[model samples]
Target: MDLHYEVLGQGKPIVMIHGGGADSRDWPYLAPLLAKHYKVITFDSRGCGQSPSQTEAANYIMDVLNLLNHLSIEKTVIIGHSIGGQIATEFALSYPQYLQELVLVAPALAGFVHSLDLLESFQAIQSAAPDVSKMTELVVNSPFCSVIKDSTHSKLMRVMTEHNIRKMFEWAAFGAVWPKPPAIERLHEISTRTLFIRGTRDHEDSVKIETHFRAVPNIQFVAVAGGDHMLNLTHPEELYMNIVTFLGEPNKQA
Candidate 1:
């Protein structure tokens, strides 16, 4: 299925993929900042936003390939967040020749899964027949406690709950199948220049991702101080600057 995506600014391409339960709009704050230096593209993965869903389970690798093929993009940089980051890592592993650079934000990787609350939550969703509504609430509320900062936490929680509940449920169900991608053994195999970003205050998995990719010769890790998993939304300008620096591009023109 052809996914719906928005393109902004003009320059080398940088595709932004959102996490599960999130649409292209998840990058609204981040995309515009990057658009200043590179052509920024954000898309809703299949089964969410304006895209039509295929019967196949929502596989991150499939979505990445399809999006690249759909855009006829032979080469580009990719900035993936959360589950989207998992997809990006797989894509880089499978198609290293096509990537110019990779930026993983709060990426989920092998052994990054938490045992307590996070796994239990996902397990509950996976074992059951899928309750889109409950999952929606769960996802929206999951990050609130981690935000640390009161105002940002409250605002994001409200936005996620009120504006994208139904879409969130659909995304939750789509993501219910399969475990997060494994990148531990494959990190060294990835030749593409990579940058991994994590919020210092994010869940344990976020820090684990940083440590996982640290051994890779081509990867760099940047921790967003006082930031949460929602760094793209919470610190768009700074995130964009770091991405541009990794790509060896000039900062966006003010």
Candidate 2:
């Protein structure tokens, strides 16, 4: 599959992966800021945006590995959001040697059975297939609300709430379907440094997942106050600075 990808800047590589439902366009605003420090690459995952998936079940980790191999990037810092975070986590577990660091933003690391409520909401929206306006209304007015202010909420919803493909949406729900990684059980197996960022008021599952990673031997978790699930959009400056600081931190002594 020919996945659509964009690269910016030049230096150590950083691959930015977007959450489910939304595509790589989710990174346009934030990727440029990160590019100032390192090479930044963002792309639509298969089945979303410009990339189309031929198989009913898309294995995103393979696509990610292929993308990196195609670019000849031997090592990278993977910065991923939501479902992309899941892909990144599994990638780190399966190929820890290829990653310098793993940075997750409001990741969906909690188990699929645990995230059933989120799944159900997504399913409800998929079943309804609401247009942009209606989906925007639901995003702005729902209890699952996380975006900070009306203006920011409107802006993000405007950008993300457009796709209404039910099959793809269900595919995302299933894509999100996985038992929590044994990474939780074998966090020490990962030698790469890891960073977990979450909104203080993000969904309950996110908070729990962040807490779980806190015990990972080489990981740190930072909570952004007054931020929501989509902290990159709601509080980009805060998120950006935290990432910079983490990336700049000294390596652990052997």
Candidate 3:
């Protein structure tokens, strides 16, 4: 599938992958800033935004690989948020030769087991089969919404969440089969330079994911003081600076 994507600027390539409930629009605030220094590619993952939905579970890694191959991009930096981060990690493991570096923002790791209560709560939400309004409200109240101080960005997030909630559910129904074999045990296999960024206000799972990545030889972890899961929207400047600094490091050269 030729997923929807847009590329901007001119320089070394940098691919930005949005979170589970978001699309390419999620990077609007940050992409242009990064574009000043590098080519930025943003895309809607399978079943999100402008991309066609699939009846079967989507292989995010393959979808990303397909996109890169379609553009004839052999190697580039991969920046991903939430589940997107999980995809980046898998790509680094499965196709390390194709990555220059990996940047994960409040990433979700495979096999980081959720509590039974949390699982039950998600099941309940799934059972309720929320309408867009209900899902928007739930998302607004979730940790993902915390620490978002900008009203305009917050509204944009709500709108995007409502727009993509149905597809999110559709993907969920297909089951959580992504990042197969789990990434926790495969961290050491990732040789690509990596940067893991977590917000202080983000969920505990992000912290756990960061902890596991510590064992990876080429990984660097940074915590944003008051940032949250949506740092690309809420703290784009800070995130951009961190990314730019990492990309500029002498050791990160392709």
lDDT ranking from best candidate downward: 3, 2, 1
TM-score of model 1 vs. true structure: 0.83
Model 2 scores worst on lDDT over the 10 consecutive residues at 170-179
Compared with the true structure, all predictions reach lDDT values of 0.72, 0.73, 0.82
Tens digits of per-residue lDDT for model 1, 1-254 = 47788889888888888876567867868888778777888988777667765455666676677778887888999988887887788788888878988899887775455648777776665554355556545555564236633545445544553444455444435433433345777777888888998878887766766777876788888888877877777777788788877788444422
Candidate 2, position 119, lDDT: 71
lDDT-best of 2 and 3: 3
Per-residue CA lDDT of model 2 for 61-172, tens digit only, reads: 7888999999999999999898788788878888887898899998876343456777777666656654545655555554445554354445655555465243254343
Q: Give the 10-residue window scoring lowest on summed lDDT in candidate 3.
A: 171-180
Q: Output the lDDT of residue 103, model 2.
A: 93
Write down the TM-score of every candidate. 0.83, 0.84, 0.91
Off by over 4 Å in 2: 110-112, 115-119, 130-144, 164-188, 249-254
Q: How should the candidates be ordered by TM-score, best one leading?
A: 3, 2, 1
lDDT of 3 by residue, 30-105 (tens): 9999888788899998888988876676788888999999989998999999889988988898998899889998
In model 1, the clashing pairs are none
